[model samples]
Target: MDGGRDSEIAMGAYQPGYLATRNRAARGQVHGFRVALWQEHLGRDAAAEAAGDLLQPSSLACVRRMNQVAEKHWAMFADDSFRGDLPGHLMAYPVGVGSGGELLNTRDKFPDTNAKVLGTKSNILPPILTT
Candidate 1:
């Protein structure tokens, strides 16, 4: 939201390609797919290092590394470079999408009958302070 300010802008590159699930295998937001995939690449000793950066956006490292692993049951892969071939500028934001939705168990998980609560009668924030 800081559109304008004569100051240095800092960006953290933690990364973001991990498949999303309601389930958690590690700490907050760590993907199980990423954990196992990384585990295979690293030895007994610094395997944790591979698990560290699963969230880097459009992370080719995650995709490529996952495909290399022998176990395919937990892995889902198709692209060789996994969008690595795309230009760097193109990879910034909104360049891609998500994992395969298991079209079977999926119903309208957010049923329209009950999801209207977000815009319900009183979801208000305290008014912003002014200078």
Candidate 2:
């Protein structure tokens, strides 16, 4: 698949793949996702590594290593994603008619919604800035 990029594209990689991208489109009018890293699932050595990696001066290596820890916790708590133990109903939403409502539970559905909310001219900031 052409160095796996084609697969990523096929799987909707061209979309707003990060929270920052979505927030930028909304002109900073967005509250970003809250990521609580639950380290109980990490073993002693891995936990130590994560702590050291996270505490180090911000760098690509530190960020990358911590991201691996986040990924592990996310996989374990996909339904909650570190929002604490919420009831099932709190995590569920009704599917809109014929709108692939089944996908609302997925991370890929926000781009279209963001476009509708922020792409409109009505949502634009005025060209002139005043104190």
Candidate 3:
């Protein structure tokens, strides 16, 4: 994994006053693992072979494990049995920083070219004008 991608994942593992966002990250991790398994063990180009391999007992077990972990985390987020005091400070700090970091990282990867096109203009025209 790229250092930048890993850092973004780490930052996303938190949300203000709630751990639900971390659960979302966990789900993404499972998907990543599935993608790796598909690319490596079954080969990305071999769709038929991948399907066959996924039917095997070992593959089934791996799928089951991933599903179980995802279910557990999802339940934590969905459940609202308790109505105790919220962790305001804990929620505010981590969620904001983590979300901001993610936004910065994403923007770094794909910059807004509108600024370059518009130049010093206070109001720029639509993309259609440039095309």
Candidate 4:
């Protein structure tokens, strides 16, 4: 799972097997699921600046793969201000906060990795968001 301060501070709440930093949120990632950093700094250290005004630092954790499925589905429950699709196969909902992926059936899947975003030219809406 890839999440924010909540995931970093209290990962036990999410219970993810392999975790990444969700670069879009915190600008960091796990290397081989071993090491994690909030953000990479060159000559000077900017951990404080990069952290912005967060109350806590970002999280870094790892473990063996937990769930193994033939397919993966991603979903998002983010703040209302967020206005875009998730980085991976995940889709966003105008709500709370969550990251990473979850198991789902094919019929209930959001979208496969190959799914594409629709534009003005396409009249059909993505079924992922439809019930």
Q: Which has the greatest lDDT?
A: 2
| Candidate 3 colliding pairs, count | 2
Q: Which parts of model 4 have CA positions greater than 4 angstroms off? A: 1-33, 36-73, 77-82, 85-107, 112-131
Q: Which TM-score value belongs to model 1?
A: 0.21
Please list the C-alpha lDDT of all candidates, in the order they appear: 0.35, 0.37, 0.36, 0.27
Q: Write the per-residue lDDT of candidate 3 for residues 1-131, one digit (tens) a residue.
A: 23434222322333344322422322345444544554453334432334444434246765664444444433333345634432111111111125446422212111223334223333576643432
Q: Which tens-of-lDDT digit does each residue in 1-131 have in candidate 2?
A: 33433222222222244333422332121212111122333444555665645433245866676556555544445543355642211111222234554323334333325323112243456523210
- TM-score, prediction 4: 0.16
Rank order by lDDT, top first?
2, 3, 1, 4
- For candidate 3, which ten residues in a row score worst on lDDT? 87-96
For model 2, the superposed segments whose C-alpha errors exceed 4 Å read: 1-45, 79-131
lDDT of 4: 0.27
Question: Which regions of candidate 1 fall more than 4 Å away from where they truly are?
Answer: 1-46, 71-131
Native-to-model Cα distance after best TM-score fit, residue 104 in candidate 1, in Å: 28
